[model samples]
Target: MTHRQVMEALSGLLLGLFVAVLSSTVVSNALPHILTDLHGGQSAYTWVITATLLTLTASTPIWGKLSDLASKKLLLQIALAIYIASSALAGLSQNTGELIACRALQGIGAGGVTALAQICLAAMVPPRERGRYSGYFGAVFALATIGGPLIGGVIVDTSWLGWRWCFYVGIPFALAAILVVQRTLKLPVVRRTVRIDYLGALAITGAVSLLMIWITLAGKNYAWLSWQTAAMVGGGLLLGALAVVIERRAAEPIIPPDLFRYRTVALAALASVLVGVGMYGATTFLSQYFQLARAKSPTMAGLMTLPMILGLALASTVAGRLITRYGKWKAYLVCGTLLLAIGFGLLGTARADTDYGLLSVYMAITGIGLGLTMQNLVLAVQNTVPRNELGAASSVVTFFRTMGGAMGVSALGALMTNKVGHYLAENLAAAHIPAGRAVAGGGIPDLHKLPAQVVPLVTDAFGHGVGMVFLCAAPFALLAFVTVLFIRETALKTDQQG
Candidate 1:
């Protein structure tokens, strides 16, 4: 394909990518308002995010395997249709339970859109030339990440539009993507005997679901070492072992067991997991921090996060072009991971009263690191794998990254809840104030409704608790940095068939 053809095809793929990313992000800033309106607590807040990620993680490899066997364009459209329908249903949700259920359905579509977008790109572009295009993916991701919050914030703040618009806003864009895909995207389908690996899929999904349930509920509902934990953890491990066995013996495994034989695939998968943990776990709560801890309006919170998004956009575009020109990528990954660790470490010291200038600087560093690291990890795996295995290999890395994200968000959110609760208690006692209705209910507080005297305590508690979340995340970033260092660099294949 000529550059023009590639760009034309990508026009639709990127739009689909943008919609997938936007769905997850646009809700970030509005989550507080959504929770408050639904009469939900911190647990509900975490589950809303976790439900999407958990389903996305579980379904990614299945979608990837299906891409290898089916029509990429047709699959993409089906995913878009599912996303549009579920997103509309989500907007009509009357309770948090309904919202979470809808979000889970949305994730099933997102898994297809995100996994298939990259798989389709690999089908069109050579490994060596893919860096330039992958950069485009990163840019769209950054745009959606930045835009989602701003859009969500504005929608929430707008009385007529309300938070529901956040779910509805992406439908038109998704619909347009489907039309564009039908018009521009073209790929040759390989004919093969298709065998769906139902047992492997069921076992892996069950395993991930059990573990995620344990992670999300362990500390809050029961002690970590309790009987519920033992049963869930033990059951999850058994299911995971069963998945490995099923994969090894199955005619068509969802995750091919032999792929792990390549050191690049294994290391990239591990590093992606760590990156997801550090990136998603720590950053998911930033909007909450800005709103609850710093008392910024949702719109202002979105604006304040611009530095990070801009940094990501700039770094991805520049690094991608450089990689294409020079055909070297490891240095960028190394620097990005290092920067990620440093950024998380710096943010760990933040307080409610910390200067905005300093926070912006820290966020930018993190964003730059992510831009350099995330897509490149997938690119690295793609460069080394045969063209035939592209979907499974790419999805392997994506699946682990998303799984790490789900785990990080669930575990860290639980920790933040406990820490915030403890601090809120201590501070309230110190101030000789009884736990008011807002405080006692344990739901996310409406700052405007709180007593002026009690506001600072809530903010301070959130500030301290959120800081601890970043502190815990910093080590994972460092581990990712180390993991990337050991991946032996392979020259990207110029052959489009690679």
Candidate 2:
């Protein structure tokens, strides 16, 4: 494909990518409202998000494996179609369970979009020229990231539009992407007899599900050190061990184990996990922080996050262009990780009375680090591996990152719940308030319904918990920095290797 043809195809592809990313995040501001309406508690709230992420993580390798054997364009369309159907159905869900089920279905399509977008793009552009085009990819991601929250907030806050519209809003955009791709994307199909590793896929899925369940329920449903915890941890590890064995023996492995033999791929995968942990864990509760702790409206919460989005947009686009121009990426990775650590370190000081100006700066710093790190990590892996292995290699990095995000959210959420419970109990006892106070509800706290004296204490507890979450995230960022230091820099390839 020529430059003009690639860009034309990418036009449709970026839109498709945008829709996938938008659907994933558009619920951030609306989640509180959704859970409240469905009568869900804190665990339910975390699972709603975790369910989607878990499916996306588990299915990514399967989608990537199929991309190598099937028609890329056909697979892309099928994924989009699934997304459209699931999103529409999710809007009609009457309860949290239904919504979580729909979200899991939605994740099946998302897994394809997230992996195949890069795979399709790599087929069209060489690693060298990919940097120039990658800037556009970064821009699209930034746009989706920025737009999702704002749109979700607006829909959530609007009485008539409501949170349901957040699900419905992306359907048209997804449909449009399908049409555009059908017309514009022209890739040569490589037909081959595909042998999918079903056992490996199932094993990995079981492992991930068990691990996530353990993380979500450990401190709440059972003691972290109890027999239930031991059983879950043992089961998850046993399943993970089974997955490795299956992958090694499979005719065509879902995730090719040999790819990890490459030092750069191994290091990059590690870095991706750490980065995902810090990024997702720290940012997941920020909206709640703004709305619940600071008592801001949904729209106001989204608007307040603008500085972070702006920094992300600017850094990703700029970093991509510069990397393309200079053909050097190590500095950006190192600097970005350092900035990420510092960002989380500063954010750890957050309190109910934290200054907006200072918080914005911390968020922007973290955003800039993410913008530099997220896309570039995949690009680095793509540069080192063979094109035929692109699907597996790319998905491996993405798979771990998504797993990290799922784990981070579950762990941090459980931590916050315990911390909040402890803090609330302490404050209530000091104030001579009973344990049955309205503010003691475990789910999304409705501040307006609480007694005047209880509201401040509840908000302060949340603020303190959020601060601890960020503090816990800081060490992960530093670990990412250390891992990036060991990744050997390889020059970007100028010719397509496939």
Candidate 3:
């Protein structure tokens, strides 16, 4: 493919990326209602989210390895097909279990969409052009991040179409993406026989699955120190150990070990994990906080999050362009991490009594910092790596980011549930109310349905939970700052390769 052809292909792929991200986030607002109507509880609602993350995390490396071995365009087409099929099935799901299963399948496809798009960008463009092109990727992510909730809210609030339409919303877009790919996304196929790493893949998936399940269930369905937790965590760790052995011995590993040999990559991976926790910990629950804690409608909640989204878009694009010119990303990464810490620290002061304007400022600060850091972190890694291993390097960082996100959501979720439960029990006892009768006791409650008297109790409890989580995640952001300090600055490369 010529330069012009590659850029055109990238444009088409980005639209597909927008669709994939939109599908994931657009239905988030309606999830609570979806689960409730399907006779599901908190765990089911979480699993609905968790299953997707788990599958995406596990399948990401597989897709990256495949991109190096076969046809990137063909793999992307297959991914879009899988997404469309899974989404349609999910829309028709009558039970939470069925829906969870379908979403998991959808996540596998989403992983392909994410992993291959990055690989394709690397295959077609040099690291320098990548910085500019990556701005487009960041914009797609921002657009989807913003649009998902707004559209979800509109669909959820529209009594005619209701929440189910949220599930169906992406079908047409997915089709369009597939058609676009077929028309515009052409590439030279990489020819070579490659092993699939089936055993390593299975073991890693199994290990991650076991750990995620344990994280989600422990301290809720069972005690944190229970036999189930012991069995799952222990077994998961053992499986992970086995996976490391397999990767070292395998001819072609799922994730190349040499990638970790570089200190920059190692630190970046760790930073990615921390960034994941700080980013997803609060951002994922922001809509819930607005709608449930503040009694805002879903549409209003979507509108309220616009500042954060806008800040993210502006910062990511501007920073990428600047980084391209200056070739100084490590400083931005450090500054971004500090901003993330400060943003969350300010957010830690949140309460039922705080105003929206103030909260938006804190959120925007976090968003801007995140915008500056998130895409650039990947750019830093991609810039530092050789052309041949770009897929593995990029996929590895992406994997940590996704994995950390899952961990953040699960761990913080557990914290929220526990804190809310304890606060409700204590306060109810003080007021001589029956703790069992308190409807919004454990975790964030459905604010729309809570009694007037209990609304304060629930919202305050949630605010405290959110604040506590920020307190926990702030240090992680700070850790990212420290890690960025150590990343050796390298000159940007402008030549296209391989």
Best by TM-score: 1
lDDT ranking from best candidate downward: 1, 2, 3
How accurate locally is residue 372 in candidate 3, as Cα lDDT from 0 to 100?
79
lDDT of 2: 0.88
Q: Identify the candidate with maximal lDDT.
A: 1
Per model, state how many residue pairs clash.
0, 0, 0
lDDT of 2 by residue, 1-498 (tens): 878999899998999999988987788878888888999888887888888889989999998889889899999999999999999999999999999999999988988888888889888888888887877888898788789888999999899898999999999999999999999998888878967999999999999999999999997899999999999999999999999999999989998889999999999999988988887775578887888889888788888888777888889899988988889888889989999999998888998899999999999998898888888898899999998888888898889898889888999889988987888788889989996884546777888888898898888888888888888899999999999999999889989864
Query: TM-score of model 3 relative to the true fold?
Result: 0.96
TM-scores for all predictions: 0.99, 0.98, 0.96
For model 1, the local distance difference test gives 0.92
For model 2, the stretches where C-alpha displacement exceeds 4 angstroms are none
TM-score for candidate 1: 0.99
Ranking by TM-score: 1, 2, 3
What lDDT does the true structure give each of the candidates?
0.92, 0.88, 0.80
lDDT of 3 at 297: 75
